[model samples]
Structure formats: structure tokens, C-alpha cells
Target: MTTDLLSLKARWADLRQQQPQSRIRDAAQQLGVSEAELLVTGLGETVTRLTGDFRELLKQVTSLGYVMALTRNDVLVHERKGVYEKVSFSNHVGLVLGPDIDLRLFMNRWQWGFAVQENGRKSLQFFDPQGQAVHKMYLTDRSDEIAYNRLVTRFQDSQQSTELAILPAAAKEIEKDDTDIDVSGFRHGWLDMKDTHEFFSLLRQYGVGRQQGLRLAPEGHAQLLSMEVLKRIFAEAADRQVSIMVFVSNPGCIQIHTGPVHKLATMGPWFNVLDPTFNLHLNETRVDQVWLTRKPTTDGIVTGLELFDKDGQNVALIFGERKPGKPELTSWRTLVDDITAAAIS
Candidate 1:
């Protein structure tokens, strides 16, 4: 006999009462269950599984007005407060193009969704098949709670069942299955790249991972940076008032913040950007390697600072602010140069 979701939820409810401050992700980890599995356990109560129209729900969510959009990986968490507007989608990819909340979404990985409430805090959380959160949107006091209520009512599942078909999580925290990699082809692809977007195709074509490709990149193309350089970059950007681009992504979505960042502070093992509208919390300890990579583009040779975890997954990417027609900003390039120089000094 297997334990039902109701029984499991009752136990979870009890555990939550014991430790009120614990987050759902941490609680799910403690229970040896996917976050989605733990979340659905509260179906018909504080949580309602969104119906088959999860994709449509994401599109329609823009009508809810002001909301806080959150996207994070294991090492970095990014939260932006704004409205979801100018929303458009193709077959597989979607975009939320508002000034404050901008995201490039990979729609295929969106597996499960729930409109959830706990202790008066309400949010809509979406997860991948492996039970990791892809993105979350929380309603704010300024947000249209009325529209939120309407959307929930419209998308609420008819069955109101708690059972969810969750896929088994990966055995290893990081995938290291690299074999038959075409190093030469990958190098050629790198040297031949005309735009940064083509890099993903290069990785897929050669079946090479991001870190592995960096490790095997042609000489003069990539250099591993020191961990200390990150703090310096943030502080210098603040002091110089240099507008830069920060890209943080998970498997499902990439969130971008472009502008000057002030109030770069470190609290224990975390590196935080304490800006008013944008917040980025990065686990400094998990950053094993930082790479300064250069790629040739039509504008010129563009440079990027890419941070990766121990498992070769990208934590974040930083680049000088530049538009399509213009070359990279000299201030941003000078900042990177200063950081690179400090690393050697």
C-alpha cells in the first residue's frame, strides 16, 4: 500500500507547523519528493493544480497587472517587480517584454503549475518534469488581485485531484556524461560564431557541454577568472555608473537585467545586488569557475564573463551593455579589463 497525497499533505502540514520559516523547496528536499509533488499534495486546499491550459495561463497572466517575476537556478536567484506585457510566443519559445520584467521562456519544459497560497502569500509556480521550479509570479499589493482570482477560477482543474505525474529526478545532481565529443568541430564552431546566440547551436552540434567547451576552447578565446573578481566587477560598475547586462538562467528561462547596479553587498556566502526594483542573490560558495570568453561578432569581438557551477551548469553571464547596431561600450570593456588586470595583479 502506498501513502496517498492527502495523508502525505497532512504530514507535511504538521512538519511545516514545526518549522514555520522553512521554504517549500527546502521542505520538499527534506521529504525526498519533487517540489511539484509536495505542492500538489495540498490540492483542493491552499493549492489548485492549473488545468491543461498552463501555457495559456502563462500568456493570460499579463492581465493580472503588476506582479513580481522570479527565475533562479541552484546558485543564483533573480527577482524583478513589474508587469508581464508585450507577451508573444511562437511554437516553443515565449517572451515577456515589459521594461521591468523581461524573460526568454522555453515553453516545452513547463510541466506542472499550481496557483498556491500559504499564510496569505499567494503565487503561481511552474516546474519542470524533474520537479525543479522554472519560474514563479507573485501578486503584489499593487497587483490586480481581482484579475488573479478570475484567472484561478478560469484555469482551475475540473477534477481538483492531487495526484500528479512527476518524473524521477536525476540520480546525479550534475550530469557528467560526456563522450565522443567533437573538440575540433566545437573549436571551429566557436571561432566561426558570428553571434552569441549561435553558441547554443555549436554546443548541440558538437555534443559538448558549456564548461567542457570552454575548457577545450582554442587558446586566446577563454580564460578562467578568479572568484574575487566578481565582487570587484559589481563595485566598479557601481562606482563608475557603467550600465551592464546581467543574465541569469535556469533550464526553462533566462532573465536579463540591464542597467547600473548599486549596493553590491556580501552577506556570508551570498553575493547580493540590493537594488530597489531588481534583486540577485548568488551563492558565492557554489561558483567553482568563472570564464572570460571572447567571441567574434559582426560588430567586433565581444567579451562575456560567464560563471559556472561544479557540474558545468552556467550560473550567470555578464557582458558590457551593447545594442545590435552599436559596438560594446568602452566603460564596460574597461571595467572587464580592470577586473582581468586585478586578477593577475
Candidate 2:
């Protein structure tokens, strides 16, 4: 059984190298062995069958190897050498060496001693695979430098407390599965004016603060100046003859439109704007929704202005198709003269 197991192990290793996707059952069949034997040899007996120190050793080695493998990525030799050189100067540099390379690989190549003789004539040594001393040094009984150096060296050599290794192989896998969305065609604009004094004043009364106008392309724009500004605009529009509709792109674009210019000859502090080739959404119905849904309203007037929290969410709405007959709203140049005339009145 032992000889057969060794032969099967060798055959398994060969098949694993040649046909990476070959299943265990297929490999066992190809080797003229039963699946039961293969399973027993490959995975060992079940945990219930494990007894004594051997079981404990098996558990420890398996767990330890798993942890070590998780962090054992190949680091550039030059980078490691640079770090070691920097650390060596400090008499006590904490470093951890893993199983990827023998101690001689660093000591022999770097010309650094690995073993040390501590106070009380105790000798400390590091060994390679062949049991040869990889490093050696000496320390006097009263030498604090030597003791500190020994502590640092031991700390550096142990693999405990190291973070998981991020391997290039894993990075490549992540890159292969990643995707990016294009948004080059998005555009945006904004409108601001000094003449909206009444609007600004009303905003301050209602706790609506200062504001800045923003526009996203294809007939969407909004004023993000201040929440107080929005409250006052909505409240005044509600009390007066004008009907207001504010639209916002999910990410961070806003658009506001007011209707029925009776008694008001101008566009107040309000402006027409849009974000072109930008990710934004027009919540034209949000104000309508609030009026229909909630009660007593909140602190500010619920203008239909959709507020996007950040730039990323704003991009999504900006990239979608535009609303039809959205008016040539992007042409701010033509509207500016009319807007200015109305605001002054």
C-alpha cells in the first residue's frame, strides 16, 4: 500500500502539471486506481480518525503553511536588499524572513552575518537548509547594543505579525475581471446673478443659505448655492403665481425651471442650465412627488431640485439619454440677456 501510494502521488503530481484542469476522479481512473484510495491518500483520514501528537502536528503544519502561503508573494530582490541595508544600520531593525528563500541567499549575497553571541557567552545562530551557519556575531555581557541587536534580528526573522501578501497573480486576475464605463460626451453648465436680492433674502429668512448654480448637458441643470436658497425659492414661487420644477442628475448635476411669469417680468435669481456629456439625472417630478407623498414638509421648501451627494452618482444620470424638446437650454449665451433683464426688474 505504501509503495502504491508513493507511485500514485508521483503520478498525481505529473498529471497536475500536464493537465491543470484534470479532475481528481479522472486522474484516479487514468492511473487505474479506485477513487476511494485516491481520496484517502490525497486528503488523509477524516479528523475523527486522527489521534495523538501526529494529529496535532498535522493541524499545526497545515494551519501554519496556509498562513505563510497567504503572505508569501515574490518581492523584488533589489527592494528587499534596499530595506535590509537601511535596517542593518540601526543595530536593531525588525524584519521577517519567510520560506521563499534560504538565509544564505541574503547573508551570503549581502555579506551580512546571521548568528550572534549574546551576553553570558550564549551563542545565537541561524541555519540554512543544509544546517550551515548563515550568520554569526558576538556580544559582551554588559553590551546593551548587542542585546538590542539580537532582539531586533529575532523579531525580523520571525514570520508572525506580517500582513497578507498581495501577489501579482491575484492583481492580474482582478484586472482581468474589471470593467470601466465611458462618459466622454457628458457636459455641464451653471447660472449666477447679483440681482436675485429678494430671492436671496427670502432664502435667509427660511434658513436657505448661499447658493451656486450648476448645469448638466442635454437639458438638465440646477443651482447648488445653498439649501436655504432652495427653500426660499420654492416658498416664494409657491406663494406667488409661478410654478417651479427643479431637476437633478443622480450624481451631482441640477436643473431648475419656473413657469407662468405673471406679475413677475423676470427670472428672479433662477437660471436655465444643463450638463453636457456629464453623468446626471433630471428629477423633474421630485417636487411633485414630495407634494403628493410627505406632510408638513421639512425645514426648507421642497423644490423639485434633486440633490446628488457626490460626483460619482452625478455621473450616472448625466450619461443617460436626454429628454425630448428639452428646449435649446444649453444655449446660455442667448438666454443671458433675457435673464439679466428679468432679474433687474
lDDT of 2 by residue, 134-222 (tens): 22222333334544343434433232211112122112111111123111222111122222223334333333222211222123223
Clashing residue pairs, backbone N/CA/C < 3 A, model 1: none
lDDT of each residue in 74-193, candidate 1, tens digit only: 788998888898888887798988888889999888987789997887899899988899999999888888889999889877887766677775664432455567677778888988
Could you tell me every candidate's TM-score relative to the true structure? 0.91, 0.17
Question: In model 1, where is the ten-residue run with the lowest total lDDT?
Answer: 169-178
User: What lDDT score goes with residue 131 in model 2?
Assistant: 24
Top TM-score hit: 1
